[model samples]
Target: MTGTRLVIDGVTLTAGAYRLVEDVSLAARPGEVIGLVGPNGSGKSSLLRAVYRVLRPVTGRVSVDGTDAWSLPVRQLARTVAAVVQESGAEFDLSVREVVAMGRTPHKRLLDGDTPEDAALITSALAAVDATDLAHRPFDQLSGGERQRVLIARALAQQPSLLVLDEPTNHLDIRHQLEVLGALRRLPATVMVALHDLNLAAYYCDRLYVLRDGKVTAAGPPADVLTPQLLDEVYGVMGEVTIHPRTGAPQVTFLPAEPHPAAPTGAEHSSS
Candidate 1:
């Protein structure tokens, strides 16, 4: 189960005439897990939108497996890339299996019915995320974490070569956050995830791309990229970076913002 190489080459994305992300380029080697980290509105999700073909880059290109992704038919692209976004558009009461079965759409003709193989893949995807018990539950009724797992199961069933997710750990408990990310890293597909947690990003990703104000500020292995100076600059917080004993990955512990030295009190500022 080899994965496709993902390349975002000098891509610039815009909303109308306003550029949201500019001249961004990053690569995920086949089967590598890459994390995008930054503050809110830093363009992590905007960059991901371009990669998943939701938002076309105003300049440059996105390529998967040596071909321009935008050039392929949507169906062909879907076969190669599957994304789990923050929200599920399925507003109706679809059961988990029914929702997961939607992933098979890329492989089926408009009128084709689910085959035994499709059933097997659906089952396997659910099991992969430990969501088998939720299979019969209404998608709308499940908690945010449960829904995240199911949506990921749907993406897995698509058998894509590259998997993209935006904040896949949102609303999940700490344990499930690790579980979900751990499963993603093990997948035989290039993964590009937009993450807000620098520590989690350090733990799971093979490389990191740090973005600020719609542009990439740094890119490298977690240990090299997650630095004190960069954190102070990008996140406006004082943080100490240390290597985790178990994973050997860089972990960031944020120190609280110190109060401004209280204005010279009383006599110091007094005319007396």
Candidate 2:
């Protein structure tokens, strides 16, 4: 009953005069991992902002469990939804554990100190993200991958019903990328993640939505959404799609486009 169902109804996202995503309707059922995949500048992040209540849609609303998310108080909204954004900065010189502990804020009263239960949750979250060693490290001192994991740990500590993340695998090594996505896959919360990696999306997401020119051009199970024609048309990249032998998920392998004749090769350019 704690898990949330998300409904985005005809959301038209915009920035100043630019229309990012228009009339877009999307849903994430409880315990579903829904992915948003698109090339850069394709409104993936923009759409997520609306779901997290950071960006108000031009003409529509986002609902969590059938209640308007934008109408809720900020603290109440935070209790139901947790977001791990791409640009989580460490301006304050806090420890990694301290940063993760901030996730418990919504659940505590104004003057409540950390309880034993809170401490236990924090410890468990750090361990889940493999950030136990960095718990005492200064937040600003960690590397990009380290910060990403720590931020994810912080979000996990929130224990929210809905989780929203943008590019959760950026800067991570292949192993950690798999680790992070795998963790997301195992969570009971409704997950909405934006990813550039098609193969990862295919592996982790229950459903995939392909965004292009600020619109969702295709949506379905990965096997149906990630076809060669769709990849070529939406991404302008030639790709081969096949079933992964182990997981039976769709696997995408990008092919090199035909080289432009006018573009010089390294040797030709050096001779010139």
Candidate 3:
């Protein structure tokens, strides 16, 4: 297989005194697309950070290809894993091509420059994200969505066996969102992405793990995990889930929450 196997077993993450994820266990086979879906403050990002080596778990282990991730050297880990996180820093002063080319750093000596092979990968990555036109432009001048696409291209250039992305569709138009995700779906890498869009996740992911309040609420295939009852319980909203006839993916239609009963009029509270 071309991709890496990821095993996150009995992992618990905490921030000082606060627990962000509690006893979470998940695994992704080579070349599978795994979705992490949950509401805000539901520990999805925290879990991702742990996988990408930003946060060390308080308990349990994260292993890639049977090796403990924490025990690997940073450069070795970077070669195997690439992450596109939400909190990307300030605008770079470099050109878009330069930023994307940075992905080659892990494989090169400090004095080494871009070889023809590196150039090809850079061009291919840009094309993969539909960002080839923006390559010559300065990265600082691009809009949010453009920068996001460029970041994704950078990750693609790394050619990691496992790719982790947090809301890669954010700031993208509908067309580009589909393009980016479709490109990811075709890659020979194991992908773990956290998404707020249920329909998109259902369409792209081979399996899903639902998080809520630092715990896993559910885990399974879309058809098995995304029932109306699960949606209501986990998201606290009424929703209808159906299979799309053509796509065969679950589609969710959310309805407004029921209103609470009104209090009695002022006259009913008056004392005689």
Candidate 4:
């Protein structure tokens, strides 16, 4: 869980004439949770893909522990980093335990069979996400929240130093959303998550990186970045900012606009 120092220097992703993400530079240190927040179409996923080596950046470099990520062998990278994307589909209808056991694939040699230790690790991972009881159940039949937990357990079984999650809270209920987020926060890895919920991001992320139009508009502690003005300008919504009484973190309240006064008719205008 330590030694995960991720750096993206001047990274840019382009598709034809359009740039998806532009000059995005940031770092995630060990034991820190950095949240990437933005509206849809804001290139958060594009930036994450570049960092996780899913999509190579057309410009700049991504380094993990001072090594060029692209140069690292695929197996080696998989051993060190684990990702939980939005999709958790298993066409073969594997059980929860089998799904979690797949995380050990990167660590296994060719033709290697699972050891007792591997089984223990998988069991622990499932328990960590509170999916132990469902270990024998079919993964495909589980609810969305249960499925997301299983996917996270799969990531945990990898024993990664860094965990990258994209919208991990999607399709989850409020309680499960908080539970998943809480489990992520408790992990020792350096976590970088692409989040749609600003409140969750503010509560859990050590720092917030606000992306807008393929660029970082603001980056800092949540209290400094999640201001009413910034949220309005970037998200195009009016909101009130408040501090959570318990955590003292930034808590936001969206406010709909009041109607504007109508303009006078032509006769009133002429008289004026």
**lDDT tens string, model 1, 1-272?**
46899899999999988889999999999999999999999898888888888899889899998899989999999888999887756675799999999999999999999999999999999988889999999999988788889999999999999999999999889988988898898999899999999999999999999999999999999999988999899999999999989888898999888855777778887785
Tens digits of per-residue lDDT for model 4, 1-272: 56399998999999888999999999988889999999998889888887778889998999999999899999999988899987746553789999999999999999899999899999989988888999999988998888988899999999899899999888788987888889889988989999989999999999989999999999999999998899789999999889999989899988878866788878886853
Go through the candidates in order and give each one's C-alpha lDDT. 0.91, 0.91, 0.95, 0.89
Compared to the true structure, candidate 2 yields what TM-score?
A: 0.93
For model 2, state the Cα shift of residue 181 in Å.
1.0
Q: What C-alpha lDDT, on a 0 to 100 scale, does residue 102 get in candidate 2?
A: 94
On a 0 to 100 scale, what is the lDDT of residue 14 in model 4? Answer: 90
Better of 1 and 3 by lDDT: 3
Off by over 4 Å in 1: 259-272
For lDDT, candidate 2 versus 3, the one ahead is 3
Question: On TM-score, who's better, 1 or 4?
Answer: 1
Off by over 4 Å in 3: 258-272
Candidate 1: TM-score?
A: 0.92
Expressed as tens digits, the lDDT of each residue in 111-198 for candidate 2 is 8999999999999889888899999999888999999999999999999999999999999999999988998888889999999999
Give all candidate RMSDs, comma-separated. Answer: 5.3, 3.6, 5.9, 6.6
Which scores better on lDDT, 1 or 2?
2
